[model samples]
Target: MPMNRIQFQPGLSMPEFFEQYGSESRCEAALERARWPEGFRCPCCGTWAHCVLRGANRKMFQCNACRHQTWLIAGTIFQGTKLGLTIWFLAIYLISQAKTGLSALALKRHLGVSYPTAWLIHHKLMHAMAAREERYVLSGQVQVDDAYLGGERGGGKAGRGSENKVPFVAAVSLSDEGHPLRVKLSPVPGFTLKAIAVWASTNLAVGSTVCSDGLACFSAVTEAGCVHQPTVVAGRKPKE
Candidate 1:
C-alpha cells in the first residue's frame, strides 16, 4: 500500500510556527496584512489615508477623511479580545492543525489560560469556521453519497435501520482535472426525497452536475435545478 499524499503532506512544525508568529508584534503584523492585503482602507469611508493612534493596549486606526476610528481587531473574530494576538494565533494554529481535534481543556493547558477563556476562544473559532462554511455552495461536477454516523447498540436494530444511526449527505466538488475541491457533510433528518431535495438546494449551486449512487432519493436533486447522474452499484463495493 502507498502512503496517502494528503495525510502525509508536510505541515508547519511547532518551531516553524513560533519562528513566524512567536511574538505579539509578529502576530499583529500578520493580522494587519491579512485584513488589508493592499493597505489600510477605512471601513466607514473606504479611504486609504489613515493615522495610527497608540492606545494603551493596541493601535487604533483613524481615517483621515471620515475621522472614523477602528481597532486592528475590530469587526473580526478577534474583536474586543483581551488576549494577546500571539496567544490567539497560537490557539488557531493548534486547533486547526490538530488531527483529532483539540478540546477546550487541552487548549487551556496549552495556552496557560483559564478554562473559561479557552472555552470562549474555542467556541468563537468554531462559530467562525461554521459561518464561513455556510457561505460556500458546491458547483460544477459534484460527487455525492449518503452517509451515516454511529452504529447499532447491543440490543438495537442493525444496519441502515439502526436506531443509533444518524443520516448525513456527503458531497465533494471536483475541478476540471477531476481533482477534489471543497466538500460538505451535512446531516439530514432522513434519507427521504424531501430531505435530499432540501439538502441539495442548500448545498449545491444551480446547474451543477451531481453524481451519486443509485439511491432513488438522490433524483430529487433535479428539483433544486441540479443535474443528477445516478450510477448503479449492483451490490459491488465502492472501490470496485
Candidate 2:
C-alpha cells in the first residue's frame, strides 16, 4: 500500500491574514488601494481629488470636482452588504483554504452570521467566480468527466436514477506528459446537451483535445470548438 503524496501550495495562514487585514479600516484601505491602484478616481466624475468626510466613523469620499460621494464597498460585489469587511475576508479565507469546500451552514457557524447571510455570501462569491472563469480556455490535451452529488437514498431508488441528484462537470488540463496541470469541478443544472455545451463554451479552451467516458452529452464539446474522444468504459475491466 503505497501512500499517496499530495503537493501543497503556499497560502496565507490565518495569523498572517489577520495581522494584515484584521480590522475593518485595514480591509477598507486595502480595497481602496486595489480599486484605485494609481489613486482615488471618483467613479462618477473621474476626479482624482477627493476629501474624506470626518465624523460618524464612516469614511465617505467626496469628489472635489463633481461632489459625488461614495464609500469603500460602493459599486462592488460587497456593496450594500451589512456584514463587516472582516467577516467577508474571513469567509473568503475559509472558502479558499477548504479542501472539500465550506457549505453555507458551515459558513454560518464559522462567521457567526445567519444562515441566509451565509448562503447569500457563498452564492455571490461562487457566481462571481463562475463569471470570471468564462474567459478561460483550456489549451492542450484535457480530460473531462461527469460527476454527481446528493444522489443517494436509503429506502428508495438509488444511483443515477435517484432523485435530488446534482450534476456537475469535472475537467482537467493535462500536460504533455499526461499529468494534470489544472482542474475544475463546476456544478451545472443538469447533464443535458445544452448544459454540457454551455459548460464547454465557458470552461474549456478551443482546439483542445478532450478525453472522456462514453457519455452522449460529451459530444457537446465539439460544438464548443474542441475535439472529443470518448472512451467506452462499459464491460472494460479495471486497469485493462
Candidate 3:
C-alpha cells in the first residue's frame, strides 16, 4: 500500500508553533509583518513616511504626510479586541489547526478564558473564515451533493425530512488530474429547485461542469449557466 503524500504532509508541531509565537512581542511582530509586508504605509494617506508613537497598550504609527494615526491592529480582525496579541494568535492557531473543528467550550478550556469570551473569539474567527471563502467561486469540473447536518431524532422525522437536520449543499472542484482542488459546504433553506438555483448562482462559475447525484434540484445548476451531469444512486449509500 502506498502512502498518500497529501494526507501525510508535514505540518507545524505544537512545540514549533509555541516556539515561534510564544511571547507577546513575537506575535505582535508577526502581525506587523503580515499587515505591512512592504513596510508601513498610512491607510488614510497611503504614504511611506510614518513615525511610531507610544500607545496605551502598543505602538501606534502616524503618517507624516497626512498626520493620520493608526494602531497595528487597526482595521484588522484583531481591532477592538481586549485580549493580548499572544492569546489571539494562539486562538487562531488552534482554530486553524483543528482537524475536526473546535467548539467554544473547548476553546474556553484551551485558552483559559470565560465562556462568553471564547464564544466571541470563535464567532469572529468563523465569520472571518466564511467571509474569505465567499470570494471564491467553484470552477472546472465540480462534484456536488446534497447533505444534512445533525441526525434524525427518535420519534421525529426520518431521512431527508428530519426536523433536526439542516439541509446543505457540498461541492468539490477537481484539478485537471482529477484530484480535489477546493471544497464548499453551504447551508440552504431546503432541497427545492429555487434554493439550489440560488446557491449555484452564488457559488459556481458560469460554464463550469457540475456533476451531482440524481437529486432533481441539482438540475437547477443549469440556471446558473453551468452544465449538469446527474448520476442516479438508487438506494445505495455514498461510499457504496
Task: Report the alpha-carbon TM-score of model 1 versus the true structure.
Answer: 0.92
List model 1 lDDT by residue over 1-240, tens digit each.
999989988999999999999998899889999989998999887999999987868978999999999899988999888889999999999999998999999999999999999999999998999999999999999999989999447887776657799988999999999989999999999888999999999999999999988687888999999998877687753321
lDDT of 3 by residue, 84-188 (tens): 888888899999999999999999999999999999999999999999999999999999998999954678878886789999899999999999999999999
In candidate 2, position 39 carries an lDDT of 75
Please identify which of the two predictions, 1 or 2, would achieve the higher TM-score against the true structure.
1
- The list of candidate 3 runs beyond 4 A from truth reads 1-7, 232-240
Model 3 per-residue lDDT at 159:
81
**Per-candidate local distance difference test:** 0.91, 0.83, 0.90
Q: Give the best candidate by TM-score.
A: 1
**Candidate 2 C-alpha lDDT tens digits along 1-240:** 655445354679899999989998998888888888897888887888989884345567899999998886777788888778899988888998888988999999999989999999999987887777765767789998888888446775566545667777989998989887888888887777899999898888789898888677888889989998887687752221
On lDDT, who's better, 2 or 3?
3
Off by over 4 Å in 1: 235-240
Looking at candidate 3, what is the lDDT of residue 62? 94
**Clash count per candidate:** 0, 2, 0
Candidate 2, pairs of clashing residues: 137-205, 138-205
> Model 2, 110: alpha-carbon shift in Å?
3.8
